[model samples]
Target: MRRPQATPARVIVFGAGATGARVVRMLAESPEVGRVEVRDPDTARLRRTVDSCDDSVTAARGLEMPPDADMVVIATPTGTQAAAARAAVNAGASAVTTSSEISETRELLALGSLAAENGVALVVGAGFMPGLTCLLARAGAAEFDLVDEIHVAKAGTGGPACARQHHRALSSLAIDWRDGSWTRRSGGSGRELCWFPDPVAGRDCYRGALSDALLLVPAFEGVERVTARLAATRRDRLTAPLPMMRRPHPEGGVGAVRVELRGRRAARRHVAVLGAQARPAQGAAIVAAATALHLIGRADVSGAGGLASIRDTGRLLRAVADRGLRPCRFEGFTLSRDETPRP
Candidate 1:
């Protein structure tokens, strides 16, 4: 069962940085949306984003969300996402955020309960790893009656500060699902080689600690093992996090995720893989747009819950692909019970 689609007449967006600006522009391109308002402390960024969009979007500075707004998107830094999300839900609007700090997010599940009670959607971690990874896992899990394990890996190049931040974030401790409960291990300690799809295959990756799958994967029955990995070239790993480096050069990159399952359909094993060559900014924009549309009832979210889950996996994949932002591909294959897994 699913709710009827109700196009949002008004939408509000917080933050006007690179990610925020991109989300505003993409939302404005949608004809179904009515008014799109952007709020940010930086007037210059506000102006730039507003100038990029059509007349339907306006710069809303030092202002509150219109109670009539159907949805509010928070694209600010991770540190302030909880506050922004809390305010949006309290203001009676559906909320979405692309935050990397989901574990530290305060009371978001509690707010989701309130939103559900109020007939609104409150979704967190709508960005890449949390966003697309969740969707891909769900889609793959659907193909089999017994999901055995899932692994998600993403690789990309950026500035030294960005790399350092990513390293520190996941370097603390890694958690994964195993034997019906969660297990802990050292971050970047479990080294494994993975063969991603073309353009970035056969790379060595280390298990990462930060992943929204920690929360979502447990929901699936028979999912005993779940982990996420991040890979960088040896040179990039050695130099990208160097604080003394004035600038870092671009490195070849690719993002890939896969799921393994065993089911009764044919007493066989199944594998599904999703890969893409994309910038983090592009992935964030695609996800933010999908979340907005889902919140407003435009996209099909048949089995979605209070939190983030892409129930209508095909629709979500289509939405992201239709955006034409980057090179993306998907595939599903079957293997024998005795076969050794590759990547």
Candidate 2:
């Protein structure tokens, strides 16, 4: 368990756009973080972001070498984050990011390792789905004698503004481990899809979005069956989130994480509905809160930087428990009276 050092803290936030704006706001409210450096190339935008912060936050263009920064969070686009992380690692700084769990190509392994070897941890996929979702999966794995399988499901009508900005890195992708080699296929895998029961729509299931499935499943050495599903609810005026975008959501959207565990005693499972239709902002806030806990060393983090699996799903869920979310059990085709999925 890492402990907060002291106040007058300093953090460097890359891309002070919307997500950066929210992150900066969260840090400002924290008594532990007193100073923040928001970095972006746009002088006008950076100035606006900095002005929004109390005297504590300073916005600047061209990120200087992080000489005295305490924590470095890279919320920039994926293509840019790898380079930014390398720079941070070279500067001997700790980093937290929601950047698409290290790309499936293992491209940034060496750069990320540099941070670890330097003793500065770089956390990846620290956002809602992969970040907290993975954390919960880790926790569920803890309860079972053997985590014979792990399934991750998440569907969003749209991503937060910050996510949309980094669409190249954020959109769904097909990935899973097989025979020791990680493989990438199309997003819509040809698996026989079963309907995940729903009240409004009823049994809607397609190839689950493959965002985290490709990056996380392999992390749990023994787990064989891992599914990452992505679904969306739209107003008919809009279409599915494209395979790419350049900004996080301006409004917001809802999503959920469900983990199915096959235990020896009795098949047990835990389902958490986070980020719902009615309150997308709250959903993003829930994820942000979980990320903050991990950032401040308040909870344990599992897996390396590429992508985050909260590893302690129970713990992560607990962190966001205040979001008015709860766990419900499910049977084959029917959800018990008490087992309604809020999202």
Winner by TM-score = 1
For model 1, state the Cα shift of residue 243 in Å: 5.5
Off by over 4 Å in 1: 1-8, 105-107, 157-165, 235-265, 298-310, 325-335, 338-343
What local lDDT score does residue 246 receive in model 2, on the 0 to 100 scale? 38
RMSD (Å) per prediction: 4.5, 6.4
Provide the overall lDDT of each model, using Cα atoms, as 2-decimal numbers: 0.63, 0.53
Q: What are the per-residue Cα lDDT tens digits for candidate 1 across 1-343?
A: 3545455458889888656877888888887688899998878879988998889999886446667887888877666677777777777777877665536443565565676556666776676656666666665566666777777776653323234445554455667777778777776667788666566677787765565555466456666777777775565446533543444332223344333333333455655565555565567667778778755753333222323253455676667777863334454444435444434
Candidate 1 residue pairs in clash (backbone atoms < 3 Å):
none
Best by lDDT: 1
What global local distance difference test value does model 2 have?
A: 0.53
